[model samples]
Target: MEEQRAPGQWWRYGPPWSRYGPPWRGGPDEAEPQHGNRRPWRSTALLTAFVLIGSNFAAHDQPHRVPLDPYARVLLLITSLLLLWRHRYPVPVAFGTATLTLGYLAAGYPYGPVFLVVAVACYSAVVAGHRRAAWASMGLLWTGHALVALWLYRWLPPAGDTRAGLTQEIVIATWVLAIVALSELARVRREQWARERADRAQAARRRADEERLRIARELHDVLAHSISVINVQAGMGLALLDSDPEQARAALTTIKAASKEALGEVRQVLDTLRASGAAPRTPAPGLDRLPELVEQAAAAGLTVEVEGEQPPLPPGADLAAFRIVQEALTNVVRHSGSRHARVVFAHDGDALRLRIDDDGPATGADAGGSGNGLAGMRERAAALGGTIEAGPRPDGGFRVLAVLPSRLKEDQ
Candidate 1:
């Protein structure tokens, strides 16, 4: 039996941490909540940036007496402004902020707040799919820090505190850089895993659709002919009851046989649909069963003729050929408006060919354009990587030919 799966639940098989596996795009519930979450987070980031800028201003208030460097404050203001657009344009924002940080370092300004901005910018770069930019920016930021340490050594030489030496500052700055680099690496892994999970989810959905289509085709092939026969037999039996008692009895018996066949096929279809453990019935009608198929169509009042030497075929080629014949014959019964049809299955070395020709009027009041039967035959042939041609024969008949690969038939 087929496994029971809930609709839209196929993504559950992907990695557990994959938040993107769920169908969030254009989903009503997720859209509003995602918007709400982003708005608040953006507001908080803006508040943090302003608060930091405010703190920097408060500390540097005694500007006139000390003659604070206006250029240094301007660079700091630019870095603060870059933070506002970091989430929206992370790579460009990181570049702008890093440029300002380098300028501040060159101007011999303190590295405290500008360093925080650089670290936040790195986070945004990783989240925004700018991993290479994030790494390059990290290297640049570290170089700037080393320059800062050198400037500090030259201007405010280390006092009694031995920890303020070149090696110590380099080591501390390297550790901070490593922390940022590692965080970006983790973010990249998370993004890759999320993408993989989403792909697997989509694949699962496609598989489900294929399975449903296969079941539909099988059910169509298995039950359609038998049910049609039953319908014909029941009507014939009802009409011939009093006048032709023996013929009526024969019609009733035909209905019983057709109904019994339908019941068995329907059970197989239902078993396939349910999740219960049921193996499919072995050996569905295929090319090997073509003789029996022709005989049955003959019994249905169509004169079928077998043609060309038989050829060995792979399972799918065999099955597709059989179905092409079955569907063709069924079409003959439904639309041909004539009693005679011919079925030909020929095997070439590399390919198997099936052709059904019926000596029926192609156009008239009784002959509507060949309906679903022709369409179904074409679909079956195409599914097997084969080609089918169906149209009016030159000699006032309808004909179909399907050429299928012998070896690659079942591969599809």
Candidate 2:
């Protein structure tokens, strides 16, 4: 029975790329939080310029704050440069930017876009799966700023500065909340992209595996049946080559026809692999070709007698039914001592019943029996939500009975 996928697990089993495999894009997995060797030079430079020029304008309005000296400008440069390593060392950059911004405030520098650097670093950290680190860094920076604004004003530069107001504190707290919320949003988005990619990769693998198994079943049925006939006819031709040339010629003709038909079917299967997403040149073999199967069995010295009227079936069930019958007769020819076989068909409501039996005391011929014949038949039946029972009958014969749904599940 096919296992059902659990809820929330999307098994796309996607398109033609299923032939080879998915195009796997490699990068840092969960074990490593780093973005792997990304160069943040351009963005770092832009942030540095924004902070420096923006701080000069901000310093104009803050009458009690210190002016932008060479040391203050140097500190701002260092803070922005730290952002370049955010993708490679997100935790360090997050903490380092927060610490530097806190120091800049303590030194009485004007409040401007310095927090922008901290925000970028923390955002990178959170998106890299280091949420705790980013939260801690932002928390510490906010705490230190609160301390300086409420109590540490006396010890700071640009003297005569008074303590900040309660309203200002509320505004600062809200600003910090907004920054953290934005970072969390970005982190969630990144995680979602990763999950979707993983889903696609899994889908590709499953589709490829299914396609391989299906092709294997087709090739097995085609080659096994045709090769069994060729083996028998070749043996006969060899024995009659000198004694009777006309009979030998007839055997060779059967061999030639059987091999040509087999090659055409094999090529049809191969074409699916060579050119995916194209329609097949020839329709797949089904019960419409049952006469050919019976004739081939006759050429191989086995007589197949049909007992019931063929029933109408959907495409999938029809193909499976043909392969099952073909494999059963092939087995009879290769392994059974009896030259006579009976194929009976009956319809039981929505299901079609197939029974193939050979009147035999077992030949036990191990030669050329791949041992996968019964297994293949069983798989074909099970695929269409059906059952197969193939075992030695109590009455000294081999019986293979298959119950297949007339309509496939997909068709319904």
Candidate 3:
């Protein structure tokens, strides 16, 4: 059987309401407005206190009955208006209410609303983040009660004992103090939770933005290199046609091979992307494919020399190393006027080191293109807890060097 919800308790929405929910209505957990004209509870408390005090004028009075003549009645009404401002100005409101009640007691008015006004003002001070003000308010109220106790003990019909009245006043003051302290504690905790939730939401948004950027970078890597190779090979084939038939045929075949290979590579990358729900595939190209990258640079009319000892690498290290060499060689082919370039890879026990130098302009290559080539290389190295540097060499050339830590752990 379905459990029925109470009609009065049922809201059109629930906890963590959707962003597209009722446009004006806010979630239940949202923070209350701190500096408002008035809280509903504060207003209601004032109304209740006013009604209670006004009714006392006609009630069967004991000793404390300040005549309900015009002056006394008007003073009571003014005190009621002051009660409404308790939340906005707690200390002042508490003083006003306590003073009026003390005068009423001394003038033999009924004690119908002393405790109600005092408690509401004390609670207001706590909610306003003014613990000190709450203590002061309570202290002032307690002093007033003490004065009233002394007055009742000294004179009046049905005289009270001073000792008993003092004890009762002390006990009531203690209760008020406890209530104020607890309310302040609750308000602090609520503010803390609100701050923590905001921090968590900001962190989540940052992570989502980072993930989107990673996807874009991966897509660029997949498409750019393949498109560049196809363009280079097609251009080579067209130039060799007619003048050198045999060489032209070889160039055409190379173009066909390069096109087919590019198509296959692009398909593999796309498949991996689509397989986000499935088990991930083996990564397509990394440091192990440096030889192929060098060969591609050679085909693009630059002579590349590979040197040093390359070792077994971690996944992150492999990707970083691949990107460094790829970007360096791409720069050589695009900007280096020198025909000769060298790539050196070294394993230094705790780290992997890579260096790519080309006889480009000694003053350094033009800072153009998407610039993501070198930027991508640096990002890859940084992601792997590594570092990279690229600049003009002392000799008439350009060089890029990178170091990937053996552990390949990111600082993040």
| Colliding residue pairs in candidate 2 | none
Per-residue alpha-carbon lDDT of candidate 3 for residues 137-247, written as tens digits (9 for 90 to 100) = 677666766765665546742244333455677787787678777777777887899889999999999988876665556655654555555555567778877677787
After superposition, which runs of candidate 3 have C-alpha atoms over 4 Å from their true positions?
Answer: 1-125, 128-140, 151-164, 230-279, 362-368, 407-412
How would you encode candidate 1's per-residue C-alpha lDDT over 1-412 as one tens digit per residue?
8447676554343232222323745444443334222322344356456635654664476332222256656666677656656665788877777777776655544434566677777777877778778767777766765665555435432232122367866775685577577767878788899999999999999989877766666667656565555555667678889899998898777767767766887787787668456666655667777776665565455677877866777777677777777777766765667778877767666777778899986424212222455566667778777899988888888888888887853435
Tell me how many residue pairs clash in candidate 1.
Answer: 1
lDDT of 2 by residue, 283-337 (tens): 9889999999999999999999998989889898999999999999998988999
> Who wins the TM-score comparison?
2
Clashes of each: 1, 0, 4
At residue 358, candidate 3 shows an lDDT of 86
TM-score of each: 0.60, 0.87, 0.65
**Residue 354 lDDT (model 1):** 76
Using alpha carbons, what is the TM-score of model 3?
Answer: 0.65
Candidates 2 and 3: which is better by TM-score? 2
